[model samples]
Target: MSDTTRDGLADRFEENRPRLRALAYRTLGSAAEADDAVQETWLRLDRAGAGEVDNLPAWLTTVCGRICLDMLRSRTTRREQPLSEINDPPSAVESVLADEVEAALLIVLGTLAPAERLAFVLHDLFAVSFDEIAVVVGRTPQASRQLASRARRRVRAAAPAATEPRGRAVVDAFLSASRGGDLGALLELLDPDVVLRATGEAARLDAQGERRGAEVVARYFAGKAQAAVPALVDGAWGFAVFIGGELRVAVAMEIKNGQILGLTAASSPAALAGLTVTPL
Candidate 1:
C-alpha cells in the first residue's frame, strides 16, 4: 500500500485502540497483558493490510480476542507469575474504577477457566454475538453459548461474594512484614488471638502446632514464608510457597474484619492437588 493508504489504515486502528484495550483487559485481568495484546493486534493489522476487511472495529476486536484467548490457554501450561512480580509499573492503558463492583468482578472473573472467561466477557459484557465469540474460542455457536451459560452461572453464584480488597491487602502486607523480619508489622496485621496450624510436610518438619496469641504467631512467621507468593487458596486470599519452582507448602488464611485470625499450612501432595490456588 502507498504512504497515504498505510497512514489512513493506521489512523483507523488508532481510533479503535481504546476499545480494543478494554476488551483485552476484561478478558485477561492484567493491565500489562492487555496492553501487550493490543500491541500484538496492531502489529497483525499492520502486516495484514485492512483492504480485505470492511468493518475495522469488529475486525480489530476479533483479533484482540483471539490473542487474549491464546494467552489465557498458555497460563495453565506455565508457572505463572502474578502481575506484582513484574519490575515495571502497571500499564496506564487500563481503565481504573475505584468501586467495589469493579474490583469484585475482576476477582470473580479470575476464578474462571480461560474459555469460559473469554466467552462470558465477549458475549455478556461487550454484547458481542455468539457467532463472533465462537470464532474466537474455536467452538460452535451452540457450544459457545454453553460456555457462556456455565460462566454466567458461576459468576452469579459468586456475585454476592468476593475476596475483599482488605483480604488481599492484608495478605500482601503480612507477607512483606514476614519477609522483612518486622515483628511489629506482623503483629499489627494479626489478631490478638491469632492461630497457626500445620499439616503434611510442614507437620513432618515440626512446623506444625496450634500456636495462639499475636506475639507467638507473629514471631513464628517473622522472617518466614520467604518463598511465598500471593495466591487464592480454597476460594480465599492466601499464599503458595515454592522451592525451586515446585510447590512445597500452601498457606490458607481466615481473615475477618481486616485482621488475620487464623492460618493453616499444608504440604501433602493430595492436599495441594485439592486446593485451587491461583495468582491473586
Candidate 2:
C-alpha cells in the first residue's frame, strides 16, 4: 500500500475502532481479549486492503466476531472461569447499554454455547440482522434466530422481574389478549418493531413467514392463539399448540423490557422432535 493509501486505511480503521472494540468486548466479556481481537481485526484489514473489504465497519464486526468465537471456544476447552468485568473504562456502547446489559448478564452469556453467545450478542444487542449475523456464525437465518432465541430464554430465566412483568407472564398475557381478539391489548404487549417468524404448520395457519411492526403483528394475532397454551418449550417459559392432545407446534419468544421483541413459531415435526416441549 502507498503512503497515502495506508494513511487513509489507518484513518478509516481508527474511526471504526470504538465500535469494533465494543463488539469484541461484549462478545468476549473480557477487556484484554477484546483488545486482542480488535488488534487482530485491524491487522487482517491491513493485509486485505480497502478493495477487499467493501464495507469497513461490517467487515471489522464480522472478523472480530469470528476472532471472539474462536477465543471463547478455546477458553471453554481449557475449562476457564466465566467472564468477569475487567475494570476497563466503559466504551461508548457499554455506556449506552449499561442499564440494558448488566454484569450478571455477562456471566450468564459466558455460560451459553459460543455460537449462541455470538448470535445473541450480535443480533439482540447490536440489532445486526439475522442475515448478517448468519454470515458471521455460519448458520442459516432461521437457525441463527433459533440460536439467539434459545440464548435469550436463558438470559430471561436468569433475570429478576421485580420491576415489571416478563417471561411466562408476558407470553400468557399475549395469548389471552390474542384469544380475546383484543387489538388494543395485543398492541400494548408487542414492541413497535416486534418481529414474528413462523415455520411449517404455524406459517400456513398464520401466513406469517416473517412479519414486523406492532400494528401488523397485533392484527395477525387478533382472534389467534386459540389452541396455543402456556407451556415450556425447550425448557423455557414459552407456549405450545396441540391438536387433539398431540404436540403440533412450539412458540419460542424473545421478550425484553416487558415487551415481545420477537416471536418464532416452530411447527415442523422434525424441529419439534428436536425440541423438548411440555405443557404448563
Candidate 3:
C-alpha cells in the first residue's frame, strides 16, 4: 500500500480505538489490558493493508475481540504480580476508564468464563449482534447467544460479592482447614475466582504479589498459617500471623456469598504498625 493509503488507514484505526478499547475493557475487566489489545489490533491492521479490509469498523471489532479472548484464555490461575502491586500514577486512559467502569461490575465480569464474557460484552453491551460475536468466540450464533444469556444472569446474581463482604463462617472453616493442612477442606472454602495478594515478609510463603483460582490459592495456604490465629484487621474479618508472640503478618479475607473472593496479607513492619488487631 502507498503512504497515503497507509496514513488514511491509520486515521480510521485511531477513530475506532475508543470503541475497540471499550469492548476490550468490558471483556477483560482491566483498562491496561484493554489498551494493549487495541494496540495489537492496530498492529494487525497495519500489516494487512487497507485494501484487504472492506468494512473497517467491523473488521477492527472482530480482530480486537479475538485478541481479548486469547488473552483471557492464555492467562494462568496464578499471576506473579497484579497491577495493583505496582505504585504508579494512572495514565490518562486508565483515569478515564476508572469512571467508565464500575468496580463491582469489573469484579463480577472478571469471574466469568472467556467465551461468556466476550459474547456478553459484544452483544449485550456493544450491540455487536450474535453473528459477529460468534465469529470472535468461534461458536455458532445460537451458541454465542446462549453464552451471553448465561453471562448476563451471572452478572446480575454475582453483584453482591462485589458490593458487600460476607462469609465469616466460611473464613472460620478456611482457617481451621489451613491449620490442619487439609487441602480438600481449604479448597472447599475458596471461590473459583479467588485471588491472594501478599506483601512484605508474607511474599516469602507464596510467590510474591498475587495468586488466583481456588486450587492455586488453596495450595498456597494448605498446611500453612499454622502460626496464624483468627482476628480482625482494621475492623474487617481476617487473621494475624504470630510467630513467638510477635505479630508478623496482618491478613484479611474479602468474602462473598459464602466463599472467599480475595485475600490480602501485609507482613512489613510499617504496614503491620497501622492495623488494628483484635484477637477472637
Identify the candidate with maximal TM-score: 1
Q: Which has the greatest lDDT?
A: 1
For all predicted structures, in order, the TM-scores are 0.60, 0.54, 0.54
Tens-digit lDDT string for candidate 1 (1-280): 8889889999998888777776787778776788899999999998888787888888887899999999988875423234344343334222333243454556667767888999988887778899999988999999999999987765654333254557878889999999999999999999999888877665433444578889988988888878888876766668898888777788888888889988888898988887656655
- Per-residue C-alpha lDDT of model 2 across residues 129-242, encoded as one tens digit per residue: 899889989999999999999988766654442223356678789999999999999999899999988877666544547888999989988998898888656545568889
Over 4 Å off, model 2: 77-93, 96-100, 161-280
Model 2 worst lDDT window (10 residues):
76-85
lDDT of 2 at 162: 20
Higher-TM-score candidate of 1 and 3: 1
TM-score, candidate number 2: 0.54
lDDT of 3 by residue, 1-280 (tens): 8999999999998888777876777677666777899999999999999878999999999999999999999988512222353243444224434332344345456657889988988886778989888899999999999999987775554433334434445667888898788888987788889888887767655454788899988888888777777765654567887887888888877876677778889989988987755444
Candidate 1: segments with Cα more than 4 A from true spot: 1-22, 28-101, 104-120, 123-131, 137-163, 204-209
Cα lDDT of candidate 2 equals 0.77
